[model samples]
Target: MFKLFLLTSLLFLLPIFHCYSLPEPCSGTCVNAHDPSIVIRPNGTYFRFSTGGKIAIHTAPDLRGPWTYKGAALPNGSKINLKGNQDLWAPDVSLVDNLYHLFYSVSTFGSQASAIGLARSPSMDAGTWTDLGAAGISSDATKRYNAIDPNLIYVNGTYHMSFGSFWDGIFQVEMNSPPTTAKSNVQPTQIVHNSAESAMEGPALFRYGEYYYLFFSKGQCCGLDRSRPAAGKEYRIMVCRSGVSTGGFVDKSGRACTNGGGTVVLESHGWVYGPGGQGVFQDPVHGPVVYYHYVDTRVGYADGQKRFGWNKLDFTTGWPAV
Candidate 1:
């Protein structure tokens, strides 16, 4: 009877013990990236494209990479006639139709004058990208949405894009075949927003089980030295899920994402600070993984010095946990 009692008590205590355990810190070299979008090539190479001069490229044999710099994806700069076209941000890459399509943001910092550009390459190697002009555009004066931070996901033979930052949060638009531009005459739907600060962006949609999970970064990103938002609130990852692809997203509390609802997925802990601008990819070996950039506060806040971060996501609870 004592053995039976102890066994029952242990089972009751197991979940409590697990809940107190800290999450696994991201390992390996994480250097020089912001708004990183990663893809594993067919040849087993990992490529990470990030924000910088014409979209920076980093390659490695594995996810825990001794990453090597391979120049910019578009060394010639964007075809868009924006003021800061060379200084790109938030690149998302995916394999489509035997070509690797890379969508990147072209914009000046702190301005809504932005355009999302497309570049395609037969290989993931640098200097091979053929610039395919502007996929979408946004301006401060007329458009309600900003077109930076583009993320593309294909669902049931259709392509959909989620892009925007700051002004009114995340927006989704359908893309026609060839996947370069948005479908003509269709308006983008506002899928996620933060009522408090209007500070949600970096929409990464992942289809897991019966739900479509929309993950986005909320609060202030970048400028860690000069400014920081509320402690533990700045640049954290939040999520909502929907049964269908286009709309009806809600948080863990059953609140609609359209009304500033989201469940916190990852926030600052230990050395990792302001971990935002995230993307999700399914690894052949590690299952589902979330990738992003975080400020290393120990190293002091330096421009372009943010480090890469990734962790295998746990979905046993029917929702993604880092």
Candidate 2:
């Protein structure tokens, strides 16, 4: 026939031109599975929020997902009066003007008194959750900064939040409503100030073209010490960019995240150690993807513990670098 129907229509348009073209690097199941937060709902469905603190809703009428698991929108196991000791850590979701706001984090391990919490789900649809309590707080360890990883950005209408970890880096605040009730003197600024080698935490924000990306992840995460793979520098997953979301923020060899810059994006080739707690979304059609958590080192723990390992992210030049 006409040259086998033009080689089967160029092999189905060559995977739609390799799914929207980018710098490329993520080769198969995109890390197979870890911390991936790709949300695309307006009636399209594709939600992913992680850290085991809960929030994983994957529904796909499209966006190429055989994906269909709509469970755990976070009401799970419950316990949060504060003093730090609840399981849910690092869960981020954002949607204002139409409701659905879920930002989570509450800690107690190497404590900086961590706390960042809020929940609501009018339309990510599954259970229609609601738990608006303690949207921000970092308990005062003399107060430099260390309020777990929470990310939400609205821009002109104001939602702005970028949390912290390790007591002295990555902070930003602004929220009046959309579920969050109070906090808007405009005061929590310090964009990025990590060092010591690398101890920065996860903070993700995005806005391409004019540039406003601020994806974060830094060294030393979880470890079981099955010898040495997941125990050294904490973790990896670095990236910096800023036309101005409140930063000079450069990396991708440009350097200058205050003085650290960070550019690796995603590390650990074989065993998968500290991949870092990260977040980035867009799945209306698989547009931009990144979700984090890693340390599968081999997966041992019963006290043999080496918890949390999840993945998916790839950007490469505009520089998500993972």
Candidate 3:
């Protein structure tokens, strides 16, 4: 009777003590990814770009393991004439015309004074990045949008750069053929904006099949301990879809994305607290994959130590499921 009681008590306390110990996505010394953007080379080498340390770069064989941190993408820092250019954020890297084009945000936290800068590298190796000043997007007190967290999307035959945060939500503008800069249009069109919550950002657009999917992070991001938000107000991955690439996005509930409508792709549950800062990629083997950075509360709540996460998406139901 004593042995049975002890076993029953241990089983009851197991869930309470080990509930947050779910499978972690990464192995090795890779718990340092924040605002991570991953791109695979032709040879299947995974290059992960992230914020801070002049946009830290990491490479790994599989998403689940053995990530080795190479040095910063721009070790010498950015040439853009902006305050705190060395402490870059939100790097969006894409392979264009045999060159890796990297777009990063140059700004201070919370202030609207920001600019998105560009850099290029032939192979994404450290010490190969050449800063190209600004990519034609700048923000100030007078502007309605904050120029940060850039995500570039190529749709149809035109190239578009989607960016913005806090002040406006999300916006996109057309880029030239080379995508060196946004067109001379002074303003970008808004794609997704939550006038009520007013806390959407990190826009990533992916075109699959007949629809264009817009994935973004919504609610309060960061400060999980210092300034933690209410339960439902924490960061989570949300998504919407549009038939065309130029706007008219709607959620799975037939609600427009402009008015604070987004279907949740991944949210805080179990130990996955505030999973966001997401980007969608078409993997060579997994087809569609969504990668993001989420704070693992079982670890620490510091912003820079967030965990890098990825999950294969199932779109057979016309909506993406993890």
Q: For every model shown, what is its TM-score relative to the native structure? A: 0.91, 0.30, 0.91
| lDDT for each candidate structure | 0.84, 0.63, 0.86
Q: What is the C-alpha RMSD of each candidate to the true structure, in Å?
A: 4.3, 20.0, 6.3
For model 2, give the 10-residue run with minimal summed lDDT: 17-26
**Per-residue lDDT for 1-322 in model 2, tens only?**
9999999989987743212222223321222233445556776655655545355555655434455566667645334576544466667777776777877778766777667878777686657877666775555577788777777787766667878876567887776756374374567777777676637777888877778878777765554353343344656667788887766888778777767677666666555555667666654444566656555545541212332333335554576544
lDDT-based ranking = 3, 1, 2
Model 1 agreement with the true structure over 1-322: per-residue lDDT tens digits = 9999999989987753212113335344467788888888888999989888678888888888878888899988888898888787788999999999999888877788888889999998998999998985455657777888888888889999988887878899999897888997899999987678788889999999999999999988877788788775689889999998888999999999988899988877777778889998788987898888887778866657788888889899988987
Error of 1 at 164 (Å): 0.8
Query: Could you tell me the lDDT of residue 271 within candidate 3?
Result: 68
- Candidate 3's error at 79, in angstroms? 1.6
TM-score leaderboard ranking: 3, 1, 2
TM-score of 1: 0.91
